[model samples]
Structure formats: C-alpha cells, structure tokens
Target: MKMEFDLRMTQEQKLIMTQQMQMSVKILQMTNMEMQSYITKEIEENPILETEKKSKEKKDDIDYKELIKYLDDDFNYSNKNYYVNNEEEVSPFTFISAKKSLKEYLIEQVIDLNLSESLKYLCMYIVEDIDSRGYLYTNKNILAEELNVEISTVEEALKVIHSLDPPGIGGVNLIECLKIQLNKKQITDKEIYLIVENYLQSMADNKYAVIAKELNISIQEAQRYGDIIKTLEPKPSRGFYTGEETNYISPEAHIKKINDEYFVIMNNDEIPKLNINKTYKNIIYNDEDEKTVKYVKDKINSALFLIKSINQRESTIFRILTKLVEVQRDYFDMGEKYLKPLTLKELAEMLQIHESTVSRAIRDKYVYTDKGTIKIKDLFITGIAQNNYDDNVSTLIIKKEIKNIVESEDSKKPYSDQKICDLLKEKNFNISRRTVAKYREELEIKSSSKRKRY
Candidate 1:
C-alpha cells in the first residue's frame, strides 16, 4: 500500500457544448412555429443577436394564420357566451389526457385502498396489461414473470382489481367477464349465469335457442339475458374522455396553395413573446445592485440561447422541407398517382443532415395543405417499379391502385393480391405479387382466405 502523489499533464480533444449537438436535440424537437416565436424573443432579449436578412418576398407566412385557424377550429375561446354557458363541455386536451393510460386510471381509483407501495405499483402494472376490450389477456404467471413477482401476488392483486368499478373491466377472458357481470347484478339464477359463461359465442352468433336448450331455459328468458349483456360497456373508458388532452396540433410547416403555387409556412404561435425587462434595464441604468445585474445577464444569455435554438430548428426544418417539396412537388399537384419513391438517406444526403435528424423532424410533425393535414414524413419512401421506366414508383400509389382494384372487385369474389398485381402490371405499373401482398397488407386489406364469401 504505497501512497504517492502523481502529477500528469494530458491534452485531449474535447467537445465543449457544440452547436451541432444542440441543433440535433433541442432545435430539432421544436417545430418551425416554435422557432419563429423563439427568434422574436431572442431579438427582444439579446442585443447581440439579429436576423441575417429581412426579405419581403412573401415566401411563407402560414405560421400566424395557421396557428389561429387550428386553435380556433378545435377550441372555442373567443365565444364569451359559449364560454359562460358551456364551460363544462370543453374537453381536456393535455399530454396526460391524450395518454389514455389505463395504469394511471387504476392508480387514481385505488388511492385509498391502503395497499403497500409495492403492491400498489404491481396493481398498476396488472391494469396496464388489460387490453382495450377490458380483457386481461396476459396470464398471471406470464405477468408475474415479466414483473419479477410471485404469481400468488398477482392473483391477490387481481382479486382487489375485480372489486373495482366497471365490472368485467379486468377479466382474463369472457368467462371472467360474465362472472364479473353476474357478481355485479347479484343474479340468483345459475341457469342464466351458465348460459352467459359457457355459450357466450353461441349467444354472440344468435345461437340463443341452442343456449336455452343447454341451460334448460326458455328461449325468451335467454333472449332477455342476452339483451342485458348488450347494455354492458365492453370498453369502460370509451365514453370517459380525459380532461388533459392538449386539443391543439401545431404544424411543423404549412403548405398553402396561393393561386396554385404552394408556399411552405412554418407554424409559430402561443410561444412566449419575450422582451428585455425595461424596468430591470432602468434599474441597471441607475446604480443597480450587483446581484440584480448578474441575474439579468444570466436571463439575457438564456433568452439568446433559446432564440438561437429556435432559429436553428426552423432553418434546418425549412431546408429539409424545401428539398422534400422540390422532390415531391409532383405528388402535391398531381395527387397520389404521381408520388415518387423516396427515402430518408436520400433526403439526408441532399440536405447534409443525419438520417435520424430527418426522422425526428417528421416524427408526429404534420403539415397543412390544400389536401388537408398531411404527415411531413409520409413523402419519403421506396418506389414501386414501372414499365419503360427503370426507376421505381411510390409504394403509396401502388397501395392506392390496389385499394381501387379491391374496391371495384365483386365482394362475393374478391380479387386475390396476385390478380391485383397482374392487373397493375398490365396497366404498365411493374410490381411483384409479393409486393402487391405487402402493399395490400399495409392498407389493412384481408387476404383471399380471410375475405372468403359466407
């Protein structure tokens, strides 16, 4: 055990708060509208920063108008009478509200259950496993394995869950669902309960006579019980809209068709309009306190950083969108038929951006156009091949074509995916049978096996 003081001098390259990293994370997360608002704030706060150029070319001015339109369209804030009379009717539109997470709902309801913290969390985990149709499709053994808890503990929590509101909401299967319903109704008739338990499928398929015969009950009594089953809400959360949904979709950009020439507008509104605190400035002008001066300086720096972040975000997004629009301009004017094959790598190379950056920019980022709200990211894809044209066409166009063929085909004898692909090839659109099936599946179309006539 030797105790020695060692001195070492090393000079290694280090990344000290690079702009590129900030641009990738902070700037890309914000939309064009957010960037614009930030830029305005920067100008107000920081005396050092200024816009590069103020061109009055009227290029893209959708930010102000589109924000006002989207907000006004979904929400009614201007109507004083409506606000006064129907205040309660306004839905909650926040991040919490939109999540619709069943775990949160269960936790809220059972706050007074007096369970231990671990058990409480376990209950929440179990609740999340319940499907939208209110069935706990995952087995307790499986859930226990997943949560690294004992199966017995899951079983115990499940019993507590069974006692919750919206009976049948936490059932493992239809048998449990009916058992919950029967428990809630306090039915004395075992025959009626048995009919619900065993012959649920037959009951669903209107095999009431079979169910009545098996239960040794009259068809009328069985029919009455079936009617009662119909009244039970399968999804207990269906009508219960959360009061936390942020009922506003601020677009990444806007494509306005002004006299047929489309203009790309970046959304920028609701962001805080910042300015230098004149009162604080006046205080500084006079014999200001050192602490106050330092605080203002820090805030001013922060404001400038925020502004630069927003401006950079807007510039990158605008550049990417410009390239996208230039490439997919034909799709904008000529409709779905003219959509070309495109990919993120191709766009990234063109704009000198990382592929992931392109992905983030388009993630949940919508663009308003004459065709309504279109996802900005949907423009890029692998093209569908065509005859006399070596390059591929858009898969979207092929799917649209497939959809058309399926829609036109006789419902009694639906066209197989192979037939649709053959038809498209004859129409000079060269596509594979597998590709047709792929596109058809993407469109959520059932295969010939599933689409068979009764």
Candidate 2:
C-alpha cells in the first residue's frame, strides 16, 4: 500500500453571486415603498443619479392624437370611449385624515405633566418603549440599565406611564392591563379584581361554574362579573394608531379586459423614473483630473446598473403577472370558485426561472384586475385534485366551500368534520375528514360540538 498524494483537475460549472447580482436580487425583493426609499437614499449618496422630472406644462400639452396612438400600440387601449378628460381623472392624493399615533398621544400627555427634566425624559422613554398593544413588556431593571438611571427612578416613571391617558397603557401583561383599567375605573369589587388576576384562563374558557364555586357566588353572578370584565378593553391602543401605519399598496401591473381580450398594463405612474444627471455627465466627460473622472465614472456605472436592475425587476414582475393572469383566467372571469391550484415551482418551471426568483418577483407585489387588487403571492396557492380529476382546485376554493357549507348548516345540528367531508365529496371535492378539520381550523371555524346550539 503506497501512501501518495494525487492531484486531479475537474471541470464544473457554478454560479458565484457577485455584489451587483446580490444588489439586484435585493432590489427585486423590495416592496414599492422600500424601493422608493432605497432609490431616494441612492440619489442622496450619488450625485450622478437623478429622478426624471415631468413638468406640468409637458404633462398638460395637447397631444391627444399621439397619446392615443401610443396607448393603442404600447398599452393595447382598444376602446376610444374609455379615454377620459384630465378633469375627470381622480387624483391619487385625495384627502386623508391624519391620526395621532399612540406614542404621540402618550408623549403629549407626558409633556403636560409637571415633573423634573430627568423624570420627564424617563417617562418619555418608558412611553416610547410601550408596544403597539399598549403594554410595556420590557423589564424595569433592563430599562433602568439602558437609560442609565436608578431602578427606583425607572419604577417611578413606569408609575407615571401607567397613570397616563388610555388606561392600561403601561401594563406588563394582559391581566395587569385589565387590572390597571379596573383600577382607573375605581372598581371596588375585590372578587372581580381577583377573578381578573387569578382566574383569567378559567374565565376565557367559559368555566363559569368553576369561577362561581371558587368565588362563593352563583353562576349568574359569575356571568355578570364576566360581562363587566368583557367591557374592559383588552387592547388599550385598539382605536389609537400604532407606529405601523396603513401602507396603501400600489399595483405593479393591471389586468384589464378590453373587447373580450385581457391586456396586461404595467403601472409606471407611481415608480420614479431615473435618468443620469446632465451636469454630472458633462463634468465627467470634460474633467481633466483622472482621479475625479474615475470617481464620477464609478458612480455613473453604479447609477446605470441600478437603473438597469429596476427595469429588469419591473419587466420580471410584469411577465410573472401576465403568466398568472393567463393561468388563472377562469378566476379573473368568475371568482374564487374558479381559482385553480398553483405552486411557485410550477410557475418557475413554466417561466424558465428559478423558484426563488419567482418568489422574489411576487414578494410584496400586487396586481390590479377586473376582480380587485390582489397580492401576487395570493394568486399562487397549493391545490387539491378533484374527484373527477379533470382539473386541480385551489385550497382557497376548498376553504371557501367549507365556509359556505358551515354558514348554511343548521345551527342546532352543525355538520361534523366527517359530514362536511361527505358534503364536499358530493360537491366533487375529494377530501378526508382530517383535511376538512384542517381547513375548518384554518378558517377559524369551531368544532361541531362547540358550534352546536342546544
């Protein structure tokens, strides 16, 4: 046996994701708002990058004939009557009432409180730390350490926060929050407070008899106490706006039906158009210093690459949406009942792109259709085969059917999972009792026993 080192050469192909490629992938996966922010940041950093400006004069110029021609050829605008006057066009910037956020509301209340600067700052810190659910889950000791203050001082600030507007805003947990609200209401009943503090779980489970026996009260009295507890707001910030504001989704593309033919319209209105800055371009072109020219050249290249990547992202999204519309034509024409089962892998194979690419393209993207504005990901659903095996039906459709059946069932004798399965089978859905139960659970529907009314 000879122990010898052997050297061999082998040829293999592999993909190495470059920095530019990674950036492109990131840009592809970004939502519209994220992409806008990213682009704005890029423009701020790189002087060579600028957003293309459309002047009001340029926009209002009388060129209806050319516009109509372009729309017909590029956008497939068939109906002439569909063309609307500019006056009738709805402005995207319609009136929206701005609501003060929970943090803002708390801060305003804290400011009015006459306290030392240190205490005020600490109170604000505690208020800021309160979560969207209007609860301060952060440990007082940890907060003290982070704020570089005494634990006693932090505790005082927390006490102040608990006393602020929107009762139960600074509680540590659900039970504590309820207790805080009860305290604010000056609830004198010790039994009610004890029930909230100790037997919240029992109350939640509707163990009224247990609560009655434990509290030495009748079941009806327990029920009355339960009703009082129910009146207390679980979520203190329920009506108040949290930090997470409602983001209005702008569709990337639209599937419009024109003259019995569906046309895919890419939405470019919302997305900012990028163009190389003419001033920077000229400076780079005429600069004598090699270093300066090189610096400008690098920035120019980066800006160009970013523009190209954005274009690629838009085109990819458009293609995916077009393919989706084509496959789910029945769904578009009708409703959820006609939606077919689809998978990312199947779509990737059909589009000749990687499954991850398909996922990235559809991530946070939306499409406006004759039906409604729908999330791109919602269009692709795992399906189950029908009894006839003619076509696959989306699990969403199955859920919808299950919901309908449950909705129409006799309340006194609600359908069981097995009965629901049988009913679905009669409707050509090949599903088991377990599958029916799973679907019911997903729909948040209770079991037949729970749903049944005596």
Which one is best on TM-score? Answer: 2
Instruction: Give the poorly placed runs of model 2, Cα more than 4 Å off.
Output: 1-9, 54-99, 103-131, 136-173, 179-194, 205-209, 216-233, 244-250, 253-270, 368-372, 408-419, 446-454
* Least well predicted 10-residue stretch by lDDT in candidate 2: 80-89
C-alpha displacement of 68 in model 1, angstroms? 34
lDDT (Cα) of model 1: 0.66
Candidate 2 lDDT by residue in tens digits, 1-454 = 9899999999999999999889999999987767878888998998877676832233234343342331212222123212111321222222223567999999999999999988999898888788889999798989989978889999888889988889888998999899988888888898899899889888776677889998999877887788899899889988778877557576666677778777676665556777666555455557798888777767767776787788778777877877888998988888877777889999999989999999998888876666667888988889788987887778998999999999999977999999999999999999889999998998999888656543
